[model samples]
Each structure stands twice: as structure tokens, then as C-alpha cells.
Target: MAVTRPLLDLVNVTAGYGQTPVLFDVDMSVAEGEIACLLGRNGVGKTTLLRSIIGLNALTSGNIYFNDADITKAPTYKRARKGIAYIPQGREIIPYLTVLDNLKMGFSASGKKAKRIPAEIYDFFPMLKEHLQRQGGLLSGGQQQQLAIARGLMCNPKIILLDEPTEGIQPSIVQEIEDTLRRINIEKGITIIVVEQKIEFARKLAQQFFIMEKGAIVEKGKTDKLADSLLHRYLAV
Candidate 1:
């Protein structure tokens, strides 16, 4: 069931690295059980914005609220413990670790005694089950991406942030990932905030969208009502 309150809220957030600000006075919110998309071209601070949300990057000012808790200064591990899962752009699974081990790492964030791997995860990505013993570095790119996502799920997150999930991924696997995300949102009620450059992919999956340019939000609205002219102006090559 969707919570009445917004799952994630950023109020007047100003964040960056080492006195160099990448985001300025950015205010955004994602409602419970909704897919919110952050769309932008490369080098527009999209990644920086996501890193700020997860506490991977420092917030020079403002507050971040997750499930109504003030978490502006929370460490990355603390945020993960609070059920904020971040799937970064590069599918950075431990190359030497077996697929099973990487998945187990995700469960550590749950702070519970995990007796068994959730069957639902395998159901979502059957290939993972088949490659339980395989090393992460040995799998194909698509398979590695699936592993990365499965690892995040082990944390039992309330909301998942995906950054450029389709980057360098095969089309078929991209579709698989998209379908799984939709199912997770509909059935499990996991709220999602996806940072994507593919306009069609974002349009199909997001209920609401925010367009960023040069470190600021340039456009935002319901996905269905996203102005084509604005998209053209912001996204044209």
C-alpha cells in the first residue's frame, strides 16, 4: 500500500563536492509508490543529484527527508539502513566475488537474520539463480546489470534509485529490467526514482518527470502532460 506521505523529499537542497557545488537550491519530491524520472543530457549534474540523495556526496546546505525523517547529515550506510537503495550507473559488482556473495552483501543492510535468499528475487531474474556460483566479472553485461539490481533488492528497500540503468545494456535486457521495475512498483509498491537519458524509456515508465539542465530543474510535470516542445528544446541533439 502506498503511504500517504511522500517517500522521499528534498527541500532547498544545495550539494556538491569540496566547495564545488553541482546542485543549487534544488527542491524535488517523489510520492510513495510512484515512478519519478529525472531526465537530462550528459554532464548536467544528474549523477551529482543522485549521489547527493544517497549521501554519497555531501550536502553543503538544506535537508533530505526519507519516510519523514530528517537525514541531511546521515552517512551513506545509515541511509541504506533506512531503506534507500541506490543502483549506481556503473554496475559495480565485486568482480572476484561470486554472484551469491554480492547478493548477500545487500542483505547486510537489512539488519535482520536472513536465513534464505528471497525466492521473489530469483523469480524476477531467473538467470541469477542459474549463475549463483559464477563470478560477477565473468557474466555478460546484461547479466551483471541484473545482479546489480538483485543486490539492491536484498536490502528490502522502500525506495530504489536507479541511475542510467540502460547505459550500455542490451535492448532485450533493458526491456526485461523495465518490466521487472513496473511489476515491483505495482505489486510490491516499491517507490522508484530513475535517472535516465532515454526519453522513450522514461516516458513509458515514469508517472512524473523532472528535466535538469546545467545543475537546475528546467522542466517538470506529469509524464502524460510533458510538453513535447520542452522535450525537444531540452533533449534535441
Candidate 2:
């Protein structure tokens, strides 16, 4: 049998803001086309982990690898051009920019020439097509989240890092987001690593999971194997 390596790898990654450290010697990997979830209670550094992967937070000590190259010190824009897309916790759409322009921004981040929005973007997010001219801030929270995801896809990334994607959304929209992510993974062959608080959503969306506490991963395994004890210990309020 042929050996397969992870498409994205974090080897002993330790990062933080300024003098205060947050992530401590963290190690993680996501195989090609896999959906992995990072779960934990508040202040466990899940968002910091995602930020580290996207080069937003500088590594204190350790290496990050993507497509077999070390990218620990790469600039944020360089990481984006190298096929890593990050959709942060807040959905961070430009309040005044039209939905079409926000999606174009993602394309521009990849150092690509600005052009017509990709038709496939509409296929993945049909609602965005309807609100192309609408200001992003005027849309509902769920709509904004969808627009954020569609914007990430504009970069044609090999892997996408989503932080708290289902936060502040209604149940119906949550289900839609789940289904669309599955399709994006299966059809587009993009690997995903999501930082999520909702256990049920993580269970349905991810194949592999990691539980973090105090800036380090305490547990990890196949999603189906995640136990109630694990959840109660690390996730319960």
C-alpha cells in the first residue's frame, strides 16, 4: 500500500500575540479531502490555532507545513496565495461593500486579476447570486456567513479554515451550511478545519476531531469515536 501524507501539517506549533503565549507546542494534521473539527470550551485557544494556520499569528516555536513545504514564517498574503483560505469567527464581511465586491476581495487576495465572479460560486451559494448588489451588512447573520464562505471559495483554496461558522445562525441555516460544506469537501476536494462550539454540528460535519484545553490539544480521534466523557470534560460549561 502506498503511504499518504497529510496535506496540511502543524508540527509542534506554538504561537501567541506579542509577549503573551496562547498555543503551546501544538501538533495537528489534516489529510486531503478530510473535514476536521477543533472543539473546546471558551478560551481554549481554538481561534488562535486557526489564526496560526493562516499565518495571522506568528509561531513562537514550531513549523507549519502545507503541500510538503514549510510555511511557518510565510507572510499572511503568501499563505493565501499558496492555497490557504481563512474565514474568521465574525464572518468579517465589509459592511459597506456589495456582496459581489466582498467575493472579489477574496479573489484579489490570491494575487489573481479581478474578473467576473466565478459561476460555481453561485452554484454553491445560490442566494448570493440574488443579493449580488446588496450591501453585506444589510443581510441577515446567516446570509452573511454564507457570503463569507462563498468569498473564501473565490480563492480556489486547497484547504479552508473556518472559525465558528455556525455561530449566531438559526437552525435551518445551520443545516444548510452543514450540507453545503459536505458538498464543498466531496465535490471540490477541499480539506476543511473548523473551530466550532456546537458538538452536534461538529459530529455531523467532521470526520476527525481534536479537543483543546489551555492552549493544547488534550484529545483527538475519528469523530464517531468521540465520547460523552470527552465532551463533558472539555466542552461542558
lDDT of each: 0.89, 0.93
lDDT of 2 by residue, 1-237 (tens): 865558999999888889999999899989999999999999989999999898888998999999888898999999999999999999999989999898899888789899888888899899999999999999999999999999999889999999999999999999999999999999999999999998999999999999999999999999999999999899994
> Residue 68, candidate 1: how far off, in angstroms?
0.8
In candidate 2, position 13 carries an lDDT of 89
Pull out the clashing pairs in model 2. none
Most accurate candidate by TM-score:
2
RMSD in Å for all candidates = 2.3, 1.5
N/CA/C clash count, model 2: 0
lDDT of 2: 0.93
lDDT of 1: 0.89
| Candidate 2 residue spans exceeding 4 A from truth | 1-4
Query: Please, what are the lDDT tens digits per residue for candidate 1 over residues 54-169?
Result: 99988888889999889899999889999999999998999999999989888887777665889999999899999999999999888888899899999889999999899888
